[model samples]
Target: MAREKRTEQLFVTVPSFFRCPISMDVMKSPVSLCTGVTYDRSSIEKWLALGHNTCPATMQTLPSTNTTPNLTLRRLIHLWISQADITPAISKQEAADVINGEFDSNSLTKMIGFINSSEENLKFVALSNHAVPKLVEAFAKSDSMRVLELIVEVLDLISMENAVREKLNELILKSDGITDYLSSFNLVLQKGNTESKVKSARILELMAVNSDSQRKIAEKAGLLHELYSLCSVETETSAVEAGLSALLAISTSRSVKKELIRFGMVKTVGKILSGYDYSSAVRAVIEKSLKMLEMVATCTEGRGAISEDRECVVEIVKRLMKCSRAATEHGITVLWSVCCLARDGTAQENVAKVNGFTRVLLVMQSDCSSNTRLMCGELVKVLREKNMKSNLAPYETKTTHITPY
Candidate 1:
């Protein structure tokens, strides 16, 4: 009863045939029990595994537990997904004009459909017509969250083109049409639901790969701060992963690292890492945050921010035990950055104080990648040199100047 109520709340008209009798989601691999009611294959499998001989939908006892696939329903679902674009088509000239900034609602709608069509011919023509600027323009003018989300989806598709990326880079530098789109995306982060926010962050992640986009996003550091806030508040793992990915991409620009530091990203990420239980859903977040922290720590300000939080360093050191080579490499790289670049003494002191040196040495001797081994060796050398210098400092003082304690 509760599941039925929740399903009704989530969708207005899910065709009864499209839904699984057990789970209620659209059936991916529908199967039928002897009792004649259909359920998703996995759902019914679990039902039978639990010794259930009754049909969930009809409450009738089944004579046999054997299942049969509903191929007709599966084929119907495939056709529906393929023909899901209900938008009307437009002429190439109309799409061209829309890309050129003409802004007809009908034409824009058709262009969105064309992009969604995923036909190589449509993709080529869209790129040939130069779509990035007008897409941003359309996105900026959109008042509806649904429209904004559609524009972002189209933008994500076109951003893959080299020409589109170059044009986007120029626009970001000039704060032209791109900035308006960015402003709207910031609003999405603030007001849109979890799905829209996830889509927006993913679009920004793709854009941030371009150096100009990174600089442009850093200029609006408040958006990055909002992403951090989203990471902290979102219960959905995918949303948090998207948020972290966007930050990671933005941190790739040398100019953007300080903004991340200013937002206290290291501490924010550390808090997430500390609470996460090991699951497939959270593994991506853990890997992404470690990589982003590595990039951020390359800058002096970032090193200072991370070093200020003792637990951040400790958390990073803890990751050396993880089986992921990428995670371990990033973790060590951040430690190396703090030890080598931070002018403040706290970063190095914390490394020694936390016994991080031992972990680095242990990983150095393991069967890890060459890069990890090399980073560990470099860190060990630095720690040894710092230790030697500290030990020799007392001996360098003049004997005559020494006073009895």
Candidate 2:
């Protein structure tokens, strides 16, 4: 019996280097990762899609989701595929277009492209070699309003992280245009359309992330005034929030906080708080404004300003009686500052005039934090101590403390 010869094609094994460590198959479109390993574009892209931030083969951390195309390796793969009579799956030209910077025409496109490429794209772009430098170059070389707007968008995206904010501060300080842009943002704060003003405020907030920048911002001519104006009267809640946010950031500096108090920032913020219509968003506004006021009130100048503004004193006392735990705590801190630092019993007299003593005692008697209760109790004690001394005044000889009900 004659056996028919079996017709079979010989199998050729792919070279180990040519295969994707992820898919364990020959790389159709190879790209070099930052880890110095090559991977097929589709396989690695899928890996990134799965939220992996390290190499599958070596398990080394990837610096960015961005990968450089291994053009030579891909060409070799194409040649190998032809020689092996293997049908190509994906179009080479399409992959080439994807690899090249053909799609990255603008910051928005670049941001979106990276984000669409992988979930880790924001982290990657933020840490990319081009990101910070490009921001500097764009600010330096371009006067285009459209371009600046795009830069702001990029800033908003990256400023979510403190790490990126620090990097941004270093890079931006090097650009004269950026410095000018920040100083001139005061004009935006003054006269720009609401959206522009809001954007300007956001940029200031980013720059004010560090102490050096905070000092620069505080020293910038009319910058704080413009920000304070925005907080005080801007009808747009976004503008108000942005302005308050920047002030809050800068208020962390002792010198800045002193300057803000001298500018009557505490009083302005208190006014905003007092008039704010109650809503979920307004609750945040209330908290930030109170926090800022408390920070300023820690300084002598701030306490003097708060005491001078009868309305602010009234609002703090009212907030102490009506707001959330945080607001009440901040209000107590401000009142304590007012009581301790008020020149010659001015803060104490102001409280007595506005029924603030009653408000403090009410909050103290309520269910509040231990810290809040302690602060409230101290404020009352201090107010009564001042009242006792003030009773020695030539006009009123009656010696009686402020009675809390």
Candidate 3:
């Protein structure tokens, strides 16, 4: 007799539950996971051990686990083997076409390319009238940011239906949604198209609403400087307001605020007083910038004491005094901080730089805003107490508070 080769038969290949039917890729979580292939070897063994033969794949309801031996049982076994061979490449496309073209479930593939490569374009082109559940599975498994941007627009174009927007939002949340694009966000905002700018602003503001860590990630990703420049310069009031709001968020973050200061933002603040056309907005920024400056002034690590910073403040105050009355509430604030710090560090001679502090005394005496007036009064009191020949405001007992915001 010929020697018989001894070999073991192979077990069925059962894949993980996440494999996409369309693309055959492993699934990313938080998507539609289909239930299919299982690996309960114990269950299969239990079914077979009873000896009434049956195919587990068919899951047919039958009476006996053991069978009387016959060619019919052999034929059934042959059919089972044939079906197993067909399953991997089986009628999948026909199934996809049926759902996508008939049910309208499968969305168009989102376009993603350089410039034209956005997600919305692809979604439009690939969208079908039918429900391609597998194609949606394909999208879920292979998420690309380019696809999501497209979906956002597609949702909007389809009248922003709740289901679509919610779906898009889910996609966004899953992708952690482009929080790093903050580096280019302002350039997007500065585009000539008003609608585009508004949309960009809204997108950025929404990201800011996430947790403190998410917000910090956005700032580190480059939002702080871009928004700071836009807040003072954008012609559109809405854009400016939005930028200011972004700045406020940035200021609230201690670490982010420190980063902004280290990035040479102090000079940027110093420059805002003159270049911006909206005096009201400009003044608001001037006040904000000074508040930041005072914090810097109090910092212990510096060669200039408060005095060097005071010189910069004196210069701005002198410039404002030329058309000083036209300055907004925030402008007076810069003056107030300047004068307050000057009182702490300056002498009789440097006060000569702006008319011997006489002009500052005048702003204190006559300015209508109570904070400005009080800050102005405090400067005079400091000067008198320091023995400077300043016949400024007679120091008032009631004007105890000197800081201006």
Q: Candidate 1, clashing residue pairs?
A: none
* Per-residue accuracy of model 1 over 216-278 as CA lDDT, tens digit each: 776773787778767878977667778888887776666667766776778888887787764
TM-score of candidate 2 against the unseen true structure: 0.61
Best by lDDT: 1
* Position 378, candidate 2: lDDT: 79
List, residue by residue over 180-267, the lDDT tens digit for candidate 2.
6564465446655555566667767877856777777777778887887788778766667778888887667678777777676866
CA shift at 46, candidate 2, in angstroms? 23
lDDT of 3 by residue, 1-405 (tens): 111111001111323232222112122211211122222232334345666343333222335443332333335434544554422211334434443442221222211111122224324333433222333343344334333333222222331223433343343433453342332344444432433343444444444444653455344544566665565456654454445555554454446556555655455545544444433324434444445544444333211332444455554555443332434234344444444644445533344444534555656655557877776666556555544454444434442332221
lDDT scores for all predictions? 0.67, 0.64, 0.40
lDDT of 1: 0.67
Task: State the lDDT at 159 in candidate 1.
Answer: 60
TM-score quality measure for candidate 3: 0.40
In the order shown, what is each candidate's alpha-carbon RMSD?
14.2, 18.2, 25.9
TM-score of each: 0.63, 0.61, 0.40
Candidate 1 structure, TM-score to reference: 0.63
